[model samples]
Target: MNECTYKNYDELPLMLNVVQVAAVLGISRAGAYELVHSEDFPTLKIGSRIVVPKDKLREWIDANTAQK
Candidate 1:
């Protein structure tokens, strides 16, 4: 598990691995796993691999930007 905090979503690549996502979100791989299960985060399952779409992530950020 790793922790990361990416200040700019635009700086993230279009496709990111789970570990990278975890790093960007400042969460551990386990926490990311939980998020995937809840379907609240953006992820795409290709075959047996999980990938996150940067654009979708940006949209989610936009939606949550003003949250308290």
Candidate 2:
């Protein structure tokens, strides 16, 4: 984590929207939604939008990458 990195959830000023998350993970929007509904996925709801924390996404990416 550099200066752009966030140490806490509160420190994160923006979140990766569903589409962005899907894009980062190379998945479709429907796939992202499916993961969102699954117990395996972590998410947050703010009013009407669902946003995934960048750190959580990074963790997910790390886990998956390590599997390979």
Candidate 3:
């Protein structure tokens, strides 16, 4: 992945695929998949594709960070 091509999560499209989520979270692709599979992870399934909504992703981050 090109570091130059990375976008801030806030600047990403409204919906993000797993790879983009991984990039923003700085996690491995497999870790991103695992996160999306969690019951509490914010995700939407369209047919066979799983995507994370940008707003929900931010909400999830906020919620998690607030607990620390």
Local distance difference test scores for all models? 0.77, 0.70, 0.86
**Each prediction's TM-score against the native?**
0.72, 0.66, 0.84
lDDT of 3 at 63: 84
RMSD of each: 2.6, 6.8, 2.3
Please provide, for model 3 over 8-68, each residue's C-alpha lDDT reduced to its tens digit, 9 standing for 90 to 100.
Answer: 5557889989998888887888899999999899999999999999999999998888553
Poorest 10 consecutive residues by lDDT, candidate 1? 1-10
Task: Write one digit per residue (lDDT tens) for candidate 2, span 1-68.
Answer: 11223345455445777776666666788888888777767688899888888888767767767552
Measured by TM-score, the strongest candidate is 3
Better of 1 and 3 by TM-score: 3
Error of 1 at 57 (Å): 1.2
Off by over 4 Å in 1: 1-10, 66-68
Arrange candidates, best TM-score first.
Answer: 3, 1, 2
- CA lDDT, candidate 3, residue 54: 90
Span of 10 residues, lowest total lDDT, candidate 3: 1-10
User: Model 2, which residues run further than 4 Å from truth?
Assistant: 1-13, 64-68
